[model samples]
Target: MANQASIETRDVRLWYGEFQALKGIDLDVSRGRITGLIGPSGCGKTTLLRCFNRINERYDYVRTEGSLIIDGHNIYAPDVDLIELRKRVGMVFQRPNPLPISIRDNVLYGYRLHTPKAERSRGAEDEALESALKSVQLWDILKDRLGDRATRLQLEQQQKLCIARLLPLKPSIILMDEPCSALDPDATAKVEELIRQIAGEFTILIVTHNMAQARRVSDECVFMLIGEIVEHGRTEDLFIAPKDQRTADYIEGRFG
Candidate 1:
């Protein structure tokens, strides 16, 4: 069954300085399901993804003119609280960025930003941190080495930890921008498994160049072209029986 709408963009448009990046895209990402955003380079997939969490709001002359709604709240509104929206719509970047602190401190960093630790009891923060790590299958590996520097871990492990850090806040949706682009096959498989395991708990929207990775992880897929979505449907039909020639061409490796 098609899941509930987790995020919806209506005629969304974005521009940087004088150049337009996203050209009035209208897309819906369903809750509790993985949605893939695939297109050629510079097709605005990442720009469109950044809009969900208001990440583009910081860019000068990056004006947007359409409604971008998350959980019934219009994020583009001037009155919208960006901090709250960002906390709810956490993002994982392509590269894993662990802070220059200990492993335990890295997980606690975002928590400190969102909540007060001193006001809470002794075990509350650590409990939440551990729970998040366990959810991402990193607790076992890092438990004994919590005092170690985050930069010391393997690249893949650090990436998973970056994801683990977000879980402490209990985000309703996750925005992943080519999160597995830098990982090897083994690491990518592990992250994919983690995504599958956590899907029903939180809505996930990913932008990727890897068609197979999208096919493997996403329940629904959107194929974009030149800043416009050409097709979107259940992954099986979209891949097996694409409606558009462009989609077929991209899927069949005839062209990107």
Candidate 2:
């Protein structure tokens, strides 16, 4: 229960055309915790994150191997449904990409898409919208402005809205790819706090280039290099006493 893995990868490998992006990754992400993936550019951290929801398969030349299991299901199995998988494993990108529609519409878009028509009454939709916005601490500020265009909101508000939009789908896992990278220092701190507050309710896997951020937000950390994992351990231990020299060197700023 408490210690079980929500996401597990066994010797997972991936390639984009002739280029290998991931090479034999084996990892387990604990349920109801924050696991951060940190490494230099081109380290395949983001590639690995996208694998959880099978988004990387969008490219025609992209190919993957091995098993990626979420809960007890093998996501790469031929019978797996991509839409349902995505709904269960939501993603928040580096930049805020809210829709150009009204704020209320943006928050309810995913709900409307996945929910049955009979269950999408206006009162139900409004309730879902408020709950989602409150989860992201946006309800207070945006409650009266539901009809405003979402894209016109401040970057921080838009980013929070993007996360709010995912809640109505009732995802069990949340994947964040440098979610705070586009925000200012103040905004980044706020979003990091928000992530920490939501950790116990959903499994979170975040890809970050900022070592400091990894130290700050993650309960566990995985360090990767050139498509291969170098070290995986508790964040405090890994930062204080990394067993591998490459991990130590990278953390010490000796090399990227």
Candidate 3:
């Protein structure tokens, strides 16, 4: 399949109060691929990831300039619907945050919210729940435990559940902010495997501090510094032979 852009940004800049978090970011994230954003702390990796769904605008003083286009629609347009935009672009946080409700409920929460009540029959809900859990390799383990509270699962399971929930919504893009930061080595490996398995099905944009993980999971990598992109290219090219000195230094551990 030909690689197409799932997301496009032109001169995208964001500010919180008086502090500029992202400065003139222009990027094209390809469809059905994993693009990793890597940089030192406070480099605005998380801020740029949040811009896809306009989550930063939640704060009253937050301001954004320039256009952020997703799936041919400019999300910053006045007539855009925030609720629908979020459904198309899902997010996984640094930590697993599941609802206090049953596992079944958590999986169906977004589906129920976005889907019309008249079309949500018991059979359809069951199908969606099972499909989502199976996609994340949780169906065999959690199918019997669907009645249990979601928060009662293991940390790794919780994070996988978070990803599964998004699948039911059929999101075109999924943004992950350090999704494996909370897991142990073994759990991280399992989660990374899951990410790889789902790569060609959805466009994934991940912000990660783990260079090894970025190299392992991403097809393309983007390195940022102080709210600006320094380099972006194929993962191997960026790591083995970077085009920019800043990228080389960071990859070589000379400096963050």
Candidate 4:
């Protein structure tokens, strides 16, 4: 079967006040695969990632134009529910920002919010917690320390916990913005491996300044410059033989 697009954008544009951050971007992010967005700082990669969940709207002056569809739904449709949309599209930030609550609580936070108290049972909650942690490869290490504060965990584990928290919500797509930027080389590699392991189950769009990390973890790559996508192709093709001179220059380290 042909691969399906999990998210599709047609002439998507964003403006923060008078500054246009994204300029008529059209791209299709494949389902069950990892798509990497790479560019220098302020290139709008992160802004595009935030658009998937409508998080950019948090800014009062921000305005978006064009269509952004996720899993066949036009996210900007007037009837769409923001809460439900966020539940379907989760985001992980650059640094590990676990709440000071217990590890188990952190993992179950979204689950509890989306699910009513009457619908939640002890066994179901336990199962959900274990399943989420296991999916992120954190179950074995933190199983016995579920009551410990999440912020006290190591940076890598805290980051993984942030990802685990999202799984219970069963998000259709996960947006990661510079997810490993705050980690060391070793921690970054670990997180990258975890990301690869989870790719087939969920559509992932990750923004990373580290080109090597993008090549290692993503199935396809999108290169952007000055608020627009310059080139996008399979990871190997985009890196080895870019169709655009600008893409070749960026990949070859001529300029960011």
Query: What is the clash tally of candidate 4?
Result: 0
Q: Model 1: per-residue lDDT, tens digit, 1-256?
A: 3455889889988889888888888888888889998988888899888988888878778888888888888887879888888889999999988999998888877787888656665488789878988998888888998999999899889988989989878899999999999999999999989888989889999999999999999999999887788999999999999999999999999987
Model 4, residue 196: displacement in angstroms? 0.4
Best by lDDT: 2
Task: Name the weakest run of 10 consecutive residues (lDDT summed) in model 4.
Answer: 1-10
* TM-score of each model, in listed order: 0.96, 0.99, 0.98, 0.98
> How much RMSD separates candidate 2 from the native structure?
0.7
* Candidate 4 structure quality by residue, lDDT tens digits, 75-103: 99999999999999999999999999999
Local accuracy of candidate 2 as per-residue lDDT tens digits, 1-256: 6777999899999999999999999999999999999999999999999999999988999999999999989999999999999999999999999998999999999999998998779999989999999999999999999999999999999999999999999999999999999999899999999999988899999999899999999999999999999999999999999999999999999998
Candidates in order have lDDT scores of 0.88, 0.95, 0.94, 0.95
**lDDT comparison, 2 vs 3, better candidate:** 2
Q: Which ten residues in a row have the lowest lDDT in candidate 1?
A: 116-125
Write the number of the candidate with greater TM-score, choosing between 1 and 3: 3
**Candidates ranked by lDDT, best first?**
2, 4, 3, 1
Model 1 global lDDT (CA atoms, 0 to 1): 0.88
The number of clashing residue pairs in each candidate reads 0, 0, 0, 0
Can you write out model 3's per-residue Cα lDDT over 8-99, one digit (the tens) per residue?
99999989999998999999998999999999999999999999988988899999999989988899999999999999999999999998
**What residue pairs clash in candidate 4, if any at all?**
none
